[model samples]
Target: MTSSRLAHEHDEHVCPRFHRAIELVGKRWNGAVIRALMDRPRRFGEILEAVPDLHDRLLSERLKELESEQIVQRRVYPETPVRIEYALTQRGRDLERILAEVERWAHRWLPQPSKS
Candidate 1:
């Protein structure tokens, strides 16, 4: 048997749960939305402002997705105008360390964005 083929056979296997997680967080704007909420609970408008270039429709979709995933908690206040806030659930908050590590890695290896 070839040495390279033996090495390929012994390659580290990817966990299905981890792969699903990457798909979830790596979705467009999902990471940014999660990061925004990591600070604290926020209104819909606040999240929009926190993530520049994020469109209203897209944000709505992302929130619903996160909610379905049980990563974000959406609370509604019944009042005259009715208010809503989005916060991270414990499951979501659990991602803070992972996100922070990604942030650190980015800072070290990724280039800064060029101002237009």
Candidate 2:
């Protein structure tokens, strides 16, 4: 009946799914990379430019992780230079609704800076 106990019980039910999701997308720059690929396919350099703060090494690792998750696909064009592009898979696109909802919630409840 206590508030702490209630929160503990609620966490027990929510933490597994929450933690698993965080493990996948909460890693540094992972969410940004996903967002970058949301609209259309982008080349590796394009993704790096999209997330200006992310370093090349970390970006490479995150892309490989996403590819393994099946949320992203890596396509290689059989052209002269072997153009490579990264795109969001259908599974990745499924996060759009959830991301939009999160954005809405953050705008409502999170702090905003004053335009002094």
Using TM-score, give the best candidate's number: 1
TM-scores for all candidates: the values are: 0.88, 0.78
What candidate 2 gets wrong by more than 4 Å, as runs, is: 1-12, 109-116
- TM-score of model 1 vs. true structure: 0.88
lDDT of 1 by residue, 9-113 (tens): 558676588789999999999999999999999999999999989999999999999999999999999987999999999999999999999999999999999
Residues 1-115, candidate 2, lDDT per residue (tens digit)? 9999979989778667777887787787888899898889999999999987799999999999999999899999999989999999998898878777766888999998665
Q: What local lDDT score does residue 103 receive in model 2, on the 0 to 100 scale? A: 65
The residue pairs that clash in candidate 1, if any, are none
Q: Which lDDT values do the candidates have, in the order given?
A: 0.95, 0.88
In Å, residue 103's CA in model 1 sits off its true spot by: 0.6
How many pairs in model 1 have backbone atoms within 3 A of each other, for residues 3 or more apart or on separate chains, i.e. clashes? Answer: 0
